[model samples]
Target: MSTQFGAASTTDDVLAGVDLKGRRVLVTGASAGLGVETCRALAAHGADVVGAVRNLAKGEAATAAVRAAAEASGGSFALIELDLASLASVRAATDALVASGTPFDLVIANAGVMAAPFGRTVDGFETQFGTNHLGHFVFVNRIAGLIREGGRLVNLSSAGHRFSDVDLVDPNYDTTPYDPWQAYGRSKTANVLFALEFDRRHAPRGVRATAVHPGGILETELARHLGEGEVEALVTSLDERNAAAGLPKFQLKTIPQGAATSVWAGVVASADDVGGHYCEDCHVAEVHEGESMDGVRAYALDPEKAKALWARSEELVGETF
Candidate 1:
């Protein structure tokens, strides 16, 4: 039970000495960045990994390293087509997964879009909400039955959740002004809430869920929408927010370091202890009040709000799971 890892931990550090010969894992957005690193680490430890990506052509090239790593550990890796921006793609991907009859030991909702200019997904919901929250909501439910009893669901959230709680009543910004950061925050909050409700409902079945705020942000694909000046402004904003939260000075993390918390939540943490918790820096993060960064907010972890959001999501997606 000792916390053997920290912000400096890597995926290999968390998985060291742990055997995953027969384990199955699925990582969303595995075409590049943290997703690629996560799969490479898992596959190197003998876990069969499926990397879900939006572009199969690009994904195949991206996952080549993972496949090579699997060879050394007697594991395997493959890419599956998945576009979170499109519900049809989600369903199609889920159908393929179910038909394959693979009992996944862990599913990491790792793909996300951040702070993009105002837009809607193909499904007509706000781009962030639709792609980051609702897309995973439907995809996970469709594959829920395939997860083994002792499996885990690792939902990748962000420190940005502190920016705003989800405006459930008008999540799509129907009447409100569209602020990109606020929308991203709302989506990240939904990620946390989803993990909360998911753990509440399924923990008894021995499948636990966790939401992770991977520390140390850097320029990643998630920043695709930011222009040159905007990126610099974001860095300054993050530092100011951390100071306001009474946290230490901020330092951007390399991809491997940033991916550590999610990897820990997915494979290293004990299911019974970590389910439904918001994690960062390889441990449970504190809930900070009146802060726009650094830790989880109370609203994101509220059970009642989680349930309400779950229901709203079901309605938005027009299906009951």
Candidate 2:
């Protein structure tokens, strides 16, 4: 039986009585929203946290806020620079962290861009694909050595992955029409595939990985690219569908609520032996058969495809496992 919690759970609720003293954790995009909450919760539980962010100013402010929150709650925190859109930035940040020599007990790959317009990164890759997925791929491989035995890695995926997979023949829209949603979907799928492959390759060494859907929390950096109308249309559509299907209307979760599933996947006892599982609402997601548009897409879980993506990613980032 799959154990799952509902969207109502908060970070404190999920992490109740859990102690993270001496644990080292890295959370990307911790400037605001869910990332801030996750950082505060883990720090409050006694974990030493590293907030990896893009802008130094925003990062400093966010770090200050997190530290203040943690101190208010009696906890600790720090910050690091990591611009996921730039390969050079990723390398510089990785080199600094590696040099620090602090082995990470947990890594929450929580940074990502959502449905953004057509744009490329400094390395000439699609912005969404580059930052939301490729950057993380390189980041994970770079830090694979830092993860302690029994460490865990969590990738933040979304239901948006239902839109598509990596366009193997032309992943960068080099010869086709550029569709932002498709690109975002491909990136999210990559998140899942990355976790699956990472788990397969590292679980034997006592390192495990999981990908999770953090529920539809509208109040996030993920929606920064969407216009008010687009956001309203998407939100309305989902709400209407839920009503028609007799399901609960999608509600914007509090930051702590949004961070719950991630915390659960990162440290819950019930998930001790669970790796390579796509999770949501604090539990292992069921394999959906009828609709390819919902749940775990086949390509996302295909070990062969996962391996292939890893190889291509290595080539792109010039990093080898």
* Per-candidate RMSD, Å: 1.3, 2.0
Candidate 1 local Cα displacement, residue 233, angstroms: 2.1
TM-score of 1: 0.97
Lowest summed lDDT across 10 adjacent residues in model 2 is found at 286-295
- Ten-residue region with minimum lDDT total, candidate 1: 287-296
Every model's TM-score: 0.97, 0.94
Please provide the root mean square deviation of candidate 1 (C-alpha atoms, Å).
1.3
For residues 106-126, could you state the per-residue lDDT of candidate 2 as single tens digits? 999999998899999999888
lDDT (Cα atoms) of all candidates against the true structure: 0.89, 0.84
Best by TM-score: 1
- After TM-score superposition, what is the CA distance of residue 25 in candidate 1 from its true location, in Å? 0.1
lDDT of 1 by residue, 89-108 (tens): 99999999889887899999
